[model samples]
Target: MAMEEKTPVTLGHRSRTLTAEEIEKLSDDKETVSDFKQRKLEEEAKKHWDKFYMRNETRFFKDRHWTTREFEELLGQDFELPSKATGDQPTLLEVGCGVGNMIVPLIEEGSAFRFLACDFSPRAVALLKENPMFSKGSHRAFVCDMTTSQLLEEVPRESVDIVTMIFMLSAISPEKMPTVINNVFSVLRPGGMVLFRDYGLYDQAQLRFKRGHKLRENFYARQDGTRAFYFSEEVVKSLFESAGFQTKENSYVTRSTINRKEGIDVPRIFVQSKFVKPQARYLMQFADGV
Candidate 1:
């Protein structure tokens, strides 16, 4: 079957889904990394990410200024405590906060929520703490391996009001995803929420992998030694729902990434979703379609 090609329209424009033939072709490579190598990749995931931040510093990823534009729930009143309230400021924890790409922007945007950010890479955490904004607000940056460590040690259980997993969870091995999800769930308040975005199945990055890059089904070890697992909407829904989160929103988010200098334009697929940790007796519903 001939793969139907899509022409780029405009940056950030919605993109069409890949046909089955395209998906099959992209994943057809039979060769995969050896089990011994796969184990090494898993064991050194942190070291690779640390080296990544060490080399790239704060320059690799752009500031995620578009976060509020895409997930407006960040600015919702739920996270903004009443001016007169005596309680501690509402807390938002960012898991896998690399160099504060998401943290710095939200702070700059005049957000009122307190921030608690953690990353597996110690170097990334150090860089984030060095950012001028880190000391200016109610923000804390720390090093944590959520897959193997308990977030409760760093913060009180159910103390967080929101957790953002932007472009971060894909780096972990699939077997540990549940552990990470449960860690996030443990720290969230009863009515808290998780705002998630990560690479999706058939994303251009996924299709670009060649033979031997496949660590396992839908998972790959990049040349940098950092791993990524492309997600499906069903996988997103199932992982969170099974961890006791109620799904509020879960779907594929598509856009075209273009490079005019190289005359290259390609569709990028990402899964963006919202899942809520329900209150014992009630589940909060937003009128704005959170």
Candidate 2:
């Protein structure tokens, strides 16, 4: 008898139901940690990220290739940056921008736009500045901890045209996720948008965590001391909405990568969304008259 060849599913396009065992293991009921401990860990968020950058420098994650493809808004079609009387352009702030992976490509590919990219890790910001693509005219790199810091102080309130939180918010504790969302909301212009993508709940990497590494609910600490959180589409939507954002697109993207030599498959899931700070009611009314 001959074995039948199976068709392969491309990564991030296929989704599967969680097994009973997986559901049971991923349940939050089993998690038991004191609020004090959780708070302590959350406070140390910056220390861990700083250490990660000090250790990996610019080699940790590969530059993301999917930002523009997934976000046509980044292409500058919906709204054009008014040609500046002084050559100034619309602004974008990339929270948790590590080593300029996503923004570098955006700068290299898109029309000229001002950028304010920051991270909790000073080393990451340093590396980003060192990149040949980094420019003082269009890009500025800073260090900020989204959990406790404020974006309004750094970027003018209601001035930023877009905030890209790509895989960055999950590093924040669930307790501070609201603060992060609110900060994004504050910096964005009345009609500005947030382009977001982060690990989705039940992704293979989440299920692959070793026993005892789980920190709380969907959050986990890796062997390197850096932490991550998996998110559900609904949870993310609520977070942004609660912060006064109007959700435009919210959905999960699942892809699988098969390793033939190892006879293994890895499924990656991401929740990608577009949310806008509602144009101020006055602006809405005025636009209606226009």
Candidate 3:
């Protein structure tokens, strides 16, 4: 079979900085909310996300080749290929794969891999199914909520070779993050790897949260009412290690983007980590060429 060539799409620039009015509104929006009020606000936010994707579908985020560039840098050149297996393509699962932002690029690259993408939002999953870039013959996309559902029931236990969580975890509630991690671990094959990337502590988003927008410590509400939690390296490491995976690479990546008008530089911290599942006895025997 001839491999298909892929052209990378560049996502055009968007300013991360908010205007004065936006910032002021953020500060004033939730000034007197109580804990019960905050929970209500969060429920409303979830509805907003559902409506947002339902209307815009997969176009909410610009289509770009983010997965290949970012995952390669984090895991090295051979990261996308299957290890310890011959004559079989690796199987991958993407949790919170909204509109095939990463999955489309992976398929276009013509790698020897198969994928299963899951998202909690039905709109997102429907959009994924309609995407031309996805091959229904070999790829699967479905709606599954990792925090509360049994991942193994939907995705086979110990069958996935790579799992991706790019910009996905922080969108989940902080209290439910561990449950998501454990669910991901359940579906991952022995010796499989996990690639993760998300917003880090003290990023611009964190500093921009209004006084009453704090849902819990470190979690913030956006103008659209969507909430996100900024993570620290220590918190991420503890979460994964506690879930029985070894952190092979963990680092804080800082990137500076310029405000072309003001000539000011803004730094964003992104925490990236790669974790590996310990091979079960049967898989270790296979790696040893038994």
Candidate 1 lDDT score relative to the true structure: 0.85
> Which regions of candidate 3 are displaced past 4 Å?
1-33, 41-46, 73-76, 79-87, 261-263, 281-290
Instruction: Quote each prediction's TM-score.
Output: 0.87, 0.84, 0.79
Q: 177-234 in candidate 1: lDDT tens per residue?
A: 9999999988888878899999987788988887779988889988999989998899
- Model 1 misplaced regions, further than 4 Å: 1-24, 77-86, 281-290
Error of 3 at 72 (Å): 2.6
Model 2, global lDDT: 0.80
The best candidate in terms of TM-score: 1
Best-first order by lDDT: 1, 2, 3
lDDT of each: 0.85, 0.80, 0.76
The best candidate by lDDT is 1
Q: Candidate 2 has which clashing residue pairs, if any? A: 11-255, 11-256, 12-254, 12-255, 12-256, 13-254, 13-255
Residues 1-290 of candidate 3: C-alpha lDDT, one tens digit per residue:
99998864332113244455655555455544577867776566547667779878766687657667767722336654444465465788889888888888767777556789998777888888898879544899988878776577788787888999988898887888999999988888778889998998766667666576677766877776677888878899999988989898877777887999999887787788999887753323355555
Show model 2 residue runs off by greater than 4 Å. Answer: 1-15, 27-29, 33-39, 79-88, 281-290
Ranking by TM-score: 1, 2, 3
- Backbone steric clashes in candidate 1, count: 0
